[model samples]
Target: MNIAIGCDDAAVEFKNILKDYLVSLGYEYTDYSEAPKHSSNLYADVAERVARAVASNKHERGLIVCGTGIGVSIMANKVPGIRAALCHDVFSAVRARKSNGAQIITMGSRVIGPELAKTVLKSWLDADQIDESSLPKVQRIMELEDAIQLG
Candidate 1:
């Protein structure tokens, strides 16, 4: 699946490492990074763009990074149909996809090391979407989104 990736200065290093890992795994991805290390940019801007790419079907998924991952994740989730999961561990990464059908994975460079970040991304990539049993819950989430958007 093609993915959209983005990061602010705080997570540029981890983003680069993850991008290389994606390349090594033969996965295609588009970089939507705000800027390089020396530059300053908003994580929300990068997150919104990457989330939009996924929500619009321009990309299959998104990977966004910031200092704590919280800012990016919160911003990404503001877009309709974008389930951005802030994941730090392998289990959460796997469940984010398999259970919630999250289209975006947000990571924190300050909270986790590069090696662990790679592991989480790999786990997310290797996971499957929600099964029959979990479909209703995902559907409910979409329904809630719709209801909230309407009123």
Candidate 2:
């Protein structure tokens, strides 16, 4: 899978760990990290870049990290056709992909430890491997997006 990954300064360490894990898993990915280590970078901007890549078909999936995950999730979801979920647990991570067909998963560095973050990432990736059964609901979501965007 071609995954697009990005992070703000607050989550740079966790992002590096995730990148290494992704490499270990042998998944080809694109790093959209916004800044050098310890440099302040806006989470919203990083989210926008990653989300745009997914929405544009430049990548198959996205993973963004920030202090709480909420800001990046919100910003990513603002883009049309981008389903970004802030998942902090295994169940939520699975549901984000299985139920919502979320193309992007966001994590919070301040809230979850590195080990748990890895677990969540694995859960999300595994969920994506499963057969998706929520096309009807996902279609409804797309329809809503169209309606909202058109208005």
Candidate 3:
């Protein structure tokens, strides 16, 4: 699957780990790592870039990371058409997509280790693998993304 990944300085270590994992899995991904590890990095801004790329319909999903994941998720969600969720556990990641149809997942560098982070990714990817066949619930929830109360 084509994935979009982004991270700030605080998430660099974890991001590097995920990068190799993604490579080994032969998953083609686009990364928005600010400053190239030379200068300072801004989590919120990088998250926004990742969200925007996903919103453009180029990639199927996105993964964002930062110190605590909260701030990055907030910033990514602020962008229209991007439903970014901060998932600290497997269940959260599942529900994020199953219930809300979130297209982006966020993780905390301080909260999860590389192994668990991989599990979270795998869980979400598993959800993506599930056939939508007659899943009205998923369709209805996903349709909410198109809803606009233009008063």
Best candidate (score: TM-score) = 1
Ranking by lDDT: 1, 2, 3
lDDT per model vs. reference: 0.92, 0.91, 0.82
- Which tens-of-lDDT digit does each residue in 1-151 have in candidate 3? 7899999889889988887787787888898876455545688779888899899998989989888999999999877777788898999888787766789999999999999999897787667633365367656644664575232
TM-scores, in order shown? Answer: 0.94, 0.92, 0.82
lDDT of 2 by residue, 86-146 (tens): 9999999998888899999999999999999999998999886434468888989999999
Can you give the lDDT of residue 65 in candidate 3? 88
lDDT of 2: 0.91
Evaluated at residue 4, the lDDT of candidate 1 is 99
Please identify model 1 stretches exceeding 4 Å from their true place: 35-40
